[model samples]
Target: MRLPVRIALLLILFFCADLCFSYVQKELRPQTALQERDIPNALHPLVKQNAELLQTAALKKGITVVITEGFRSIEEQNELYRQGRSKKGNIVTYAKGGESYHNYGLAIDFALQKKDGSLIWDMTYDGNQNGRPDWLEVVSIAKTLGFDWGGDWRNFKDYPHLQMIPG
Candidate 1:
């Protein structure tokens, strides 16, 4: 083979290998589950605004809150719905695919994080030593910010869930 042609072929192979590696790396990147990236920017403007307010107000009251679930993809929602139904663990949700506000970027689920970086979903937990439950304090602040706490629902009590009402 000619030296120039051989060099060109080697460069082409290197480029193809680089592209393949990039694709695989993206596919293998771990999905964000209970983190800030789970919250999509497509959420209703009010929901996003109130979520910020809830976080800030909770912080003022010595409670640390983090949004764990938001703007769920249809596949993610189906997997959650399958839990405790066709899959193992407790039934987390009754909504499927397009059924929940999360599918429309209108809802969020929260958890309290301790100073040690441990996340807690216990509604009655008061890790701040303030005598009041951190979960309730978070929810109270959320309500004031115009978010409806799922804990107030009669049928299913999702202590961490909050959604904004459409005007």
Candidate 2:
């Protein structure tokens, strides 16, 4: 009887140890995503905050603006740089890989969305008919929120781009 009780106790202890080990493994395991297009965790917090504020204010003005690009990887930036010079399409960007502020999570590009959900990159578009261009309004709000508009740059006019200069 004593031997049987000892065996049962040993089995119970073994089972409890296995369960504890499994719990610890589950807790320490890294998490992964099911979707590839999900927003990356590396976006700077200030960029996210200002982008959200810009979106909210645009919505209130009946102007729908969507952030189309942010935080591009060096590889992605390189591909964009190749577009007009090496590749077939028009030159979309002047900055190569590491040179873009997008590579540092400080820049974002936006496009206007019409009520029917069509996206437009036209800077003079006034989909809400608010008398002012929607793109300019977005740039204005972005400036107030601490972003510098790429449209104001004298060399390359990138109307959709907004960047936060690090001080």
Q: Model 2 TM-score? A: 0.73
lDDT of 2 by residue, 1-167 (tens): 69999999999999999999998876443121111123343557789888999999989998888999988988899999999888999998998876777877778999999988999998888888879988888889899999988888878999899987444
Q: Candidate 1: deviation at residue 12, Å? A: 85
* Regions of candidate 1 where Cα sits further than 4 Å from its true position: 1-41
TM-score of each model, in listed order: 0.72, 0.73
Local accuracy by lDDT, each model: 0.80, 0.82
lDDT of 1 by residue, 1-167 (tens): 99999999999999999999998876444222222333354777788888888888888888888988878787888998999999999898998866677877889999999989899888788888889888888888888787878888878888889986456
The TM-score that candidate 1 achieves is 0.72
The 10-residue segment with the lowest total lDDT in model 1? 30-39
* Top TM-score model: 2
